[model samples]
Each structure stands twice: as structure tokens, then as C-alpha cells.
Target: MDVNGFQVLPSQVESVRLIFKRHPDIAVEFRAKNQHLRNACMDFLLSLIETMCQSLEDLSNEDLVEADIALTYLKDAGFKVDWLEKKLDIVKDKKEKEQSSLARLQEMEDSLLKLKQHCSDLDALVEKEHEELSDTRTPMSFDDVV
Candidate 1:
């Protein structure tokens, strides 16, 4: 089977099927590993679209006329350009949100580290004061009271 531009051999597909049959939870594992695979596929599709757009921009008038005719046919076949655009926009928004969440997590980690250091410093100061107090001793005699 051809997935995007990559060919999936029948043997490989069979192997995956066997694994899934043996362990249904493999679906979750596969999904975890497929996150990057999905991202790569999306990136490939985006770049292909960008290259196509650039070529369209540089097309001759005759080619533009032909492209328009082809586009109309594609639209008639239920491939709307606006729908593709909206899908891309959704992916872009998801990427932005992921990045923003990562940045906030990093900020929280930094703050936690600083707070930890402050706690350590306070502990050390308290320990030093305890040691100094222990070192200083005073002896009292009955003569002093008299």
C-alpha cells in the first residue's frame, strides 16, 4: 500500500496486523511512535503544497488556463481548495499551542529550580547558626549569683 509517497510492503503490514491481533493495546504504543511520523507526513505535504503554489505562480498563461480547467475538475470531484486551507490552518494552530505550552512548562521548571536553591540556602544558614550557638558556652558559678 502506498501511504503518501512511501510504500508499505505487504509483509510489513502483515507483521503489524499480527502484532495487533496478539496485543490490542499495541494501538496506543503505535500511536505514541506515530506522532513524529504524522508530523513528518504533514511537513512533507506542506512543502509539496508550497512548491506547487510557487510553480503555479511562475506558470505561463497557457499553463494557467490548463491549471484552471484541472482545478475545476478537482473541485467537481469534491476536493475544495478552501477545505484544504482550513485543515492547514488547524494544524498551524495546534503547532503554535504545543510550542506555547512547552514554553510555559520551561518557565515553571526554572522557577521551581530557583525556589529549590533558595530553600537550600536557608537550610545552610540555619545550620550555621545552630553550629555557632553550640560552639559558644558559658559557665555559671554560685559566686556570680552571690
Candidate 2:
């Protein structure tokens, strides 16, 4: 128990009790309302997480020193910091995805704009050719149509 930094009641009896050896004052006890072991176990785990979060909440939000203190406390208690690492990894992945999506969207927009400019240029060329052909032709009153 000392090495693991936590201990559970040796056997299942009647009620649930989660006790911290270091902080004996911070403990929770409750009975199973529905007599379902799974629910009882889940509730007990949730309470533990809540207790941990509350302890973290007591740290100052503006100070890195407080954060270091919390980290030291967790490390001393043999808690794994893998959750923090996983969170940073998730944030990095999401940012990368967002940046790539933005780049693709910008590329598509540029291609569309270039296509539009090319179409406009082609339309002007067709108009200019029509005007030149009209000017070069000899004009006669109704004779051209006949």
C-alpha cells in the first residue's frame, strides 16, 4: 500500500468507503442504494475522481508554481501523468487537422478564382474577334441576307 500510494478495503462487505491514508480527513462513505455492484463501484470511482479534481481546483489558476506543486504532489503519490500527455497530443492533432483544412480551402478558392479570370478573358477574346469580323465585311442593304 505504501508503494502503490493507495489501498482498498480487503473485501466486499456492506458499505463503500474510500479512505486516503495521507489525508484521513478527506474520505467518503455511502451505501449501495440499488444493491447493484457495478453502480456502486462506479459511484465510488466517480467520488474519487471528484475528490482529486477538487484538490486540483484548490491550486491557483494564475501561477505556474502552484501547478508545479500539484505536479509534485501527484508524482509523490505515484499518480501517472499520462492523461496530461494524451491531452496535449489530442490538442496538437486537432490543430494540425484544422491548419491543413484551411490550406486546402484556400487552394481551392485560388483555383476557382483563376478559372473565373480565364473564363472572362476568353469571353473578351470572342467579343474582339466578332467585332473584327464585322468591320472587315462589306455591308449591303438586304443583299447580304439574300
Candidate 3:
């Protein structure tokens, strides 16, 4: 879904979900923007990587060097190259509950159909019994009919 012009592909979302499932300990926060400040930092770093200190650029040499070391440490600690979690507004538990509710509705419908059929059968039987009773009644003499 496109939220604020950020198109979230279903496959990408599923991949992120699978990654989270695999690494349950990892916690993710969905924010309107990148809270870690990596996006801007990465852009600076990418420019530096391509230019190799030839361009003075935005970041100073010392800051760039420090950032490189920090990134190395982060990578060593297994915290690098992770996906950002966005607020997709999906709830698995809610979906499951809806499915169960639909199943219950289907069962109720089946029961109602059965009840209607049974009532129909009872009415037919009553009608037949009344007809038989009428047939079994014997005619009486005109004086005795009263």
C-alpha cells in the first residue's frame, strides 16, 4: 500500500515479516522518518566512497573516518544491513478471529437450513394425518348426525 507516497510492496513486507520471525529478539520501530540518521549519513558515505577524499564534501575527514570505524564495529556486532519496519496496520490475530467468526456464521446457516427442513417435514406429516382422520370418519344417519 502507498502511505504518504511510500509504496510498500506486499512481497517486501512479507520478506521483512519473515526476517522478523527468524530473529525474534530484534525489535523494530515504525516512525515517519528514519530515526537512526543513517539515510543522510549513508548518502554522505557513498559520495566519499566514490570520490575517495578528493572531494571535501559535507562531512570533515575526521568525522568520516570515525563513522567508518563505528560502521565497522556495528557490522562486527551484527547490527548492520537490517530492514526498516513500517506501520502497515496489519494484525494477524484480528484476521484469525474474523475467519473463525465467518466459520461460525456458516455453521449457523447450516443449522437453520436443517431446522427449516424438519419443520417442513412435520407440517407435511400433520397434513397427512388430518387427511387420514377425515377419511376414517364414517357417515351417520341424518337423524343421528346431530
In order, the Cα lDDT scores of the candidates are 0.50, 0.47, 0.47
Model 3, residue 24: C-alpha shift (Å): 25
Query: Ten-residue segment with the worst summed lDDT in candidate 3?
Result: 83-92
1 or 3, greater by TM-score: 1
Model 1 spans > 4 angstroms off: 1-78, 137-146
State the displacement of the C-alpha of residue 92, model 1, in Å, after optimal TM-score superposition.
Answer: 0.9
Candidate 3: tens digits of C-alpha lDDT, residues 25-104: 33222222553343333333233333333333333446445545644543443443232211011222334456689799
Cα lDDT for residue 24, candidate 1 = 47
Q: Which wins on TM-score, candidate 2 or candidate 3?
A: 2
lDDT ranking from best to worst?
A: 1, 2, 3
Question: TM-score, each model?
Answer: 0.41, 0.39, 0.37
lDDT tens digits by residue: candidate 2, 1-146: 12122233444221224323333332233233343543434344434344334432242333334434444444343344445334334544555666689799999999999999999999999999999999888586697778
Ranking of candidates on TM-score, top first: 1, 2, 3
- Cα displacement (angstroms), candidate 3, residue 68, comes to 32
Model 1: per-residue Cα lDDT over 44-89, one tens digit each: 3334344335432353445434544544443443333444445444
Each candidate structure's count of clashing pairs: 0, 0, 0
Report the CA-based lDDT of candidate 1 relative to the real structure. 0.50
